[model samples]
Structure formats: structure tokens, C-alpha cells
Target: MLSFESAGRGILCNDAETRPSIWCKGVQPALPLWLASHPDCTPYDPASADEARAILRSALQALYVDHQAGFYYLATHDDTCVDTGPLHRADAQGAIKGMYRLRFTPEVSTVSTASTNGNRKTPPQIRLCGAGKALQRVLHAARLLSQDWGIAAEVWSCPSYTRLAREGRAAARWNMLHPQSRPRRPHIARCLGDSTAPVIAVTGYAQHIAEQIAPFAPGRFVALGATPQRGTAYADFPGAPWITLIALKALVDEGALSAQTLEAALRTYALT
Candidate 1:
């Protein structure tokens, strides 16, 4: 399980001497996949940021079992905004090992600047201004209530989350008391909250962080996110619900992550 205990100083190995909270959470699955695919590349191909984000979306569908209620939909980060020029290092298993991975041939491409649908078809979603602030708000809230629930959590992975304490001056409180000063940066894995029960369940690589959940701690429920792709072979999670909240809605709304046919697909993925 990924614990925040070792997260005090930094999660990423390449952090500056000053040390920052690695906030390793926001990283998409493609990061590890790139590391695993190439052994000879010095810096590793860094162009698949989109593929990683897309993979995470798929993983969320496979991992989070909504029961009757809808699971949370998240992130949907703008692909064009991510700077894939940089590299991160990873161990043999694809776990990020150092600050930099060798560069590699990118399989993902940039979004075309060409014209397309230009409108808002869905309800306006809400998120923190800065990823750090969101992390600070969510984690600080979790920590303050820790003893009450015996649920322990710490900053596991992210530079955005680290900046909250170091730069955002976030307090150990929920959004009610410590309202943010800025908007959250775009990324799906902002922060996670959990209790002694499966208050929040995750899928895919995210499930790896299941170490932070209930039966281990306490809370009514918690936050969650995931990483996925189309096929079940290269994607899908262990015990998550078949259909996802995103895909379900996508059907009627003509959105991408609709839930219409997802239930069947989910059933298939689970059976497989």
C-alpha cells in the first residue's frame, strides 16, 4: 500500500533539495506503462500523457462499483494543457523510481487545433482552483477528523497538493472554513478521503491506494478516481462496478462516458 508516512519530504525522487510533497497521485497510468515498455531509453518517451489520462478514465469505470448510486466522475483534464516534454524515472515494475524516466516514442498525439463542437452540453462541474488547494482541503479535513474515525492519511503523490501547505497556506480544515483563494488545476486525482469502511472504492492503478480505505479506518464514504482504456485486456480493474457514472450519462446526452451500454460491458469485464 502507498502510505503518506514516507511522504513528508517528497514523493518524486527528482524533487529539489528543498523537498516537496511528491503528491504522486495525479500521475496517469501511462507513466508507469512507458517505464515498463522501454528498458533502453534514457529519458523514456514522454508523449503519451493523453493515453495515460484516457487509461485512467477507463480504469475508474472498472474499479468503482456504484451499487445503485452514481459513482463520482472526475478530472477530465484538458490534454492540450499538459506539458509532456519532461520525463520521469521509474523502477523495473514501472513504479516511478527517480525524478526522470528516459524519453521514448510517444504513442499519444496532441489535440487538433481544428474546429469542432464548440459548446457546453453538460452541467457545469465544480472543482478547486488549484490542485494543491483541493488536496489541502480534502486531506486536511481527513486528518482533522482522523482520531474521530481512526483513519490515517497523508500526502502521497502530487506537486499540486504539496504547494498547498508550502505555498497555498491551506489549513487543516474542510472547504467550509478554509475556502480556497484560487481555482484548481485540471487533473483527476486531486485528493482522496476514506474511513474504516469501504466508504470510497477505487479501480485500476488507483485501487493500489486501497490501503487508505475503510475496514482500515472510518467514515461514511470517501473520494475516488481511476485510469482506463477501451479493451478489458489492457485496462479494467479488479472488483469495480461494470458500468461507470460517466459512460452511463454519455449515452443519453451523447457524451463519451455514457452509462447506457456500459452496464453490459461492465458485466462482461467483471465476468472475464
Candidate 2:
């Protein structure tokens, strides 16, 4: 069976700079590399809600198409926040097709904002993208804490490193489009609109995934992941929630989320 380690070594033995890595026996078309590497996680568990299950199935289909189409392919490393379900397949497909855009919505509503007045206003909120298991943990923790802290935050399930890399490459190849052919601003850019709030990208592959998405952030941006270091002597699952809490607290210290706001929310909750 082809193994990642053997394939990696073979590339090194050859002209490493010029040779491309090979997909091994372990890699499957239905699963992304991030998910493939982790054996313990059931990446797509059946949801309790039929609607959620249907949406997740679409997400699976989207994931397959995006990667097959040479768009980005990424997935959360493990299951956390089971209630949130999987990424939306329709959105994932649209993102890969370079036709997806996110418009900020008021009051955390999931309903589409297409019918809203063009002049609606909302508070500054950061966009959080989860590119892997570690980053997913951070995203979920930050969102829950942010709510308790009364911070406005939006979490994006970003599984596409390839899509972000392809973002501006088209401009070099296609030239300026006819005004009529030009599509509306990308969803990511619209969500970022004029807000001073930080745009944060989190992933285990910080350099590859996080860095690529940073440019799309609306204002201040942060990429969180491991620093260059020696390989680990062993592997173990880090407590996901603990890691998430630590990351969120760091954001709070950075003023990305307000501690005072959380305290106020807690006070209000206590009184009621």
C-alpha cells in the first residue's frame, strides 16, 4: 500500500524541489487529506435533525466536487460541537465555483439577507474560518465565549485551501471582465466590508491554509497555528475544548472580543 511517509521520502530522493507529492493508498476521493490522516474521527456523523442531515449530505457532495475540481480540500480533524453539523454543501460548492459571497446579517440570523434593504447596518464583527480540527475548536470556543461576552462574531466553515489560493490568479489570466459579466463582490469581501473587526483564520496548516485566507480578511487579521518546531515524539488528542478556551482568551486579551462585554452579559443573565 502507498504510504504518505514513503511517498514523501521518494520525493526527497528525487529532485524534491521539482517533484510533486503523490496521493497514497490512504487518501480517498470521498475524504480530504486532513480527515484521511485522522483515523479516529467519524467526520460526517448522521445528524439528529433530518434537515441537518440533508444539508450535511450536500456538504459531502460539495467536498467531493471541490477537491475533484482542483479547488481547495480541507476538513475538520475531529468532531467537536456536534450540534453545529457540517459545512453547508451549497455554500462549499459556490465557494469552489468562485461565485460565493457572504453578506453580513444582523442578530445572528441564518436566513438569507438578500431581501433586506441595501442600507441596513450591523455592529463590527470578526469572521472566523475553521480550516482543520484545531482551528475548528478555536472557532467554536470563540463564538460561544463571544456570545456570553456580547461580542458580535461570525464563524465560517472554511475547508478550502485551494479556493483561497486561486482567489486572484484569475485576474492575471482573464484580464478585466466586461462590466456585465462581472459578478457581485465575493461573499468573503462583502462580509468584511469596512469593519475594523479582525478577520481570523485558524488551522493546523497555518502557513498553507491560514496564510492564504488572511488577505481576504476585512480589517486586522490573525493566523493561528503551530510554530516551526521539531516533530512530535508522540501523538495524542489534545482536549479540544481546553484548547479552544485558551485560544478565545487570547483573542479577548487582544481585544478581538471584549471581556467587559462578557461580564455584562453574565450580569444580565444572573439577574434574570
TM-score of every model versus the real structure: 0.21, 0.47
Among these predicted structures, which one has the highest lDDT? 2
Please give, for residues 144-176, the per-residue lDDT of candidate 2 as tens digits.
445443345565544444444344334323435
lDDT to native, each model: 0.27, 0.41
Stretches off by above 4 angstroms in model 2 are 1-83, 86-89, 92-124, 172-187, 190-194, 228-272
C-alpha RMSD of each candidate structure in angstroms: 19.6, 11.5
Which candidate number maximizes TM-score?
2
Which pairs clash inside model 2?
72-162, 77-133, 101-187, 102-187, 149-262
Q: Model 1, stretches more than 4 Å misplaced?
A: 1-83, 87-169, 172-262, 267-272
lDDT score for candidate 1 against the true structure: 0.27
